[model samples]
Target: MAYSLDGVLVFGLLFVCTCAYFRKVPRLKAWLLSGSGVWGVFYKAAVIGTRLHAAVAISCIVMAFYVLFIK
Candidate 1:
């Protein structure tokens, strides 16, 4: 339940990418944003820290929602 740094960074990245999208950034950039979020989660998961894994898992779920429904 505490937030990890990767989670915070991923959230900030998503927010920035969303703003960029609103500013008319290309679809490629948005996809890269989402891709990097997934990469970050996978990296955290592979490293094997329980709290970090939990944070990454939560980020993945939230990002999935945004990717599926928001965009």
Candidate 2:
């Protein structure tokens, strides 16, 4: 198996999202909890031109929502 640049980029975005969620970086955490963050993730996906990354981004965004609302 081989790793692609798209995978790495998606992983990196997810990592940053996770870190921001965990660290509770004031502004970033706030953004992640809002619709804008979801939109931002989708926008990034569009720019990256990968459906897989979009799915990952959606999951990450959903996780952020879960952390903020349910957890």
Candidate 3:
């Protein structure tokens, strides 16, 4: 199939949501939380999730499906 910017955008969004969803998984969490100094701490804080992350992931996945199937 031919690839377009829409495909790339959708893939990029899904990738982000996947990272967000997986940020809490044990090994990934350690890796995701791993960084250095202030950046490390800030990185963990940024990736650590509340339900908002799930919502964002769900919405993005839905959008991804729409883009892939409909658009």
Clashes of each: 0, 0, 0
Worst 10 residues of 1 by lDDT: 42-51
TM-score of each: 0.33, 0.32, 0.49
| Cα RMSD, each candidate | 12.3, 12.0, 4.7
- Give the per-residue lDDT digits (tens) of candidate 2, residues 1-71: 02865456546666544544433456654554343545565344333434355566687686567557864
Candidate lDDT values, in order: 0.50, 0.52, 0.60
**Please, what are the lDDT tens digits per residue for candidate 3 over residues 1-71?**
12887667565555555665556577876666466775474344345433367766686778768867887
Q: Which residue window of length 10 is worst by lDDT in model 3?
A: 42-51
| TM-score leaderboard ranking | 3, 1, 2
What lDDT does model 1 reach?
0.50
Give the distance in Å from residue 67's predicted Cα in candidate 1 to where it truly belongs.
0.5
Q: For model 1, what is the alpha-carbon lDDT of residue 31? A: 44
Pick out the ten consecutive residues of candidate 2 with the lowest summed lDDT: 42-51
Report lDDT (Cα) of residue 52, candidate 1.
51
